[model samples]
Target: MKSQNIRLCFNNTVKALFISALLLFNTNLFAEDLEVTGNITQLGNDWLVVQGYTFYVDQNTELRGPNGSIVQFSFYQLNDLVQVKGNNRGDGTYLATRVKLEDVPNNSNEIELTGYVSAKGTNSFDINGTTFLVDANTIFRGRRGNPFSFDMIQVGMLLEVKALLQTNGDFLATRVKAEDDNHQHGNEVEVTGLIESKSTNSIIIGQWEFFVNSQTVILDRNNLLIGFSQLNVGDRVEVKAFKQLDNTFLAVRIKLEDNPQSQIEIKARIENIIGNDITV
Candidate 1:
């Protein structure tokens, strides 16, 4: 009887251990890999919020910048665009393995364009004639620096955009800020781009309409005086204007420019060299 009792106890113990191991294996099998890109809405010592999802970071988490340079957790800031790769925990949270900053700072490789939004799509918008694509990593802010999203964008709204030029000629918007023209009193706005349309008293560049008054000065590439009628569509120009009380941009000066050369540099290993032609 004593031996039978001991045997029964051991078997029960072994069964409980097997069940526990199975449960652990099942929990791990149900954990899903997760990858998300968005602005960091919140930051804490060991956690971050992106796109309304919380991700916990630990010592093993890898932090990096846009250039893939290793960074510290402290390097992240609220409103900074980031991409998080991790696995979802069963408890409605995620364990991040890597966090990467996605924003490219305003530099020579980037361009700033401010104008009225002429068009908008599901994931992109047009300002001044350039189409800017926005992804989960795009940061949108109001004039007062409050966080916003792409859904706030609408046609005819004045916006300031900072974007990087993509290899395929698309402008990938990194930041978009809503501007209130009413507060722009005496503030000068400048736009440099090809003229998209022209009228007897106004001209449109990209999508920005600038009114030309009798006081408006028009000059050629050489700074020589020119008439308003001399301007035409497709002409490259730099316009200095100010927001009028009625919210219209009134041109103070317009200068024509020679079409600038568009050049792009590519970095890749040369696969083959054949007399003035290289394959990469």
Candidate 2:
């Protein structure tokens, strides 16, 4: 009977150790730093909502406006497209360490764009070779006065954008409306979508094919320079390209998106097969 009790105690101790290790593994995931980019949807007394995540700002949090100018927290207004670097409190709230506003054009110099919706980012979209920044104030409409949101927008759909042009050559969209142009021609365009297939010299994004050459530049999600060989199928990418005389897209630059939330790990499965000149 004494030996039975000792065995029970040993089993309970083993279970306790396993539970503690599991808790530590989960804690590490929540302790990692986080960065989010989106439009401010709500402004509370000491907190704000970006996309859907709520973040609180303390006195030590750094704030900056356009042109990298230091600014007070009150300077940020609703619908402002901003990036927040913060730490997760592990309870669905974030403690912001820094907030930086994106460069958006003032209410002047309206420009119009008509092309495919190549890609959609946190609070921005790319159309017709230009990146258009959006905020809550930016209107989104469908054909014939229908309502739409950024989540409804997809790759390969035709869209018309009316925006203000910034001095730095980017655009700040005031309105984005959809268009039905099944027969419209592809012009100089920017596209963002998943890479359906890829080769050493080219890739297919959505319904468009982009060809790369020596002059084509490749960048990672952080805008760091990389090589074409680093790309793979199923990667989400954005491409700036020009339509050539032969109707083929000549890629000028390609940017790969490295979203931390999308990070995943997998194990490779080895297949037993023999090639023409080798055996496995």
- Deviation in angstroms for 108 in model 2? 6.8
lDDT of 2 by residue, 1-280 (tens): 4455322122322222111111112122221134556678999878898746678899988899989999989999898888776654424466787888978733324555555555578888775346789878889998887888877776555677777766776668888888764321223355566687987789986456789875566777765567899998888787766566576777766778665222222111122223421110
Model 1's alpha-carbon lDDT is: 0.66
Error of 2 at 3 (Å): 99
Instruction: State the TM-score for model 1.
Output: 0.31
Measured by lDDT, the strongest candidate is: 1
In candidate 1, what are the lDDT values of residues 1-280, reduced to their tens digit?
A: 3454322122222222111111112123221244556678899999998755689999988899868999889889998888787654423466787898886633333555555565679999875456899988898999787767898886656677877767786879998888774322223466666677888899986447888875466778766567899998888787767555466777766778786322112222234545544433
Worst 10 residues of 1 by lDDT: 17-26
RMSD of each: 28.4, 21.5
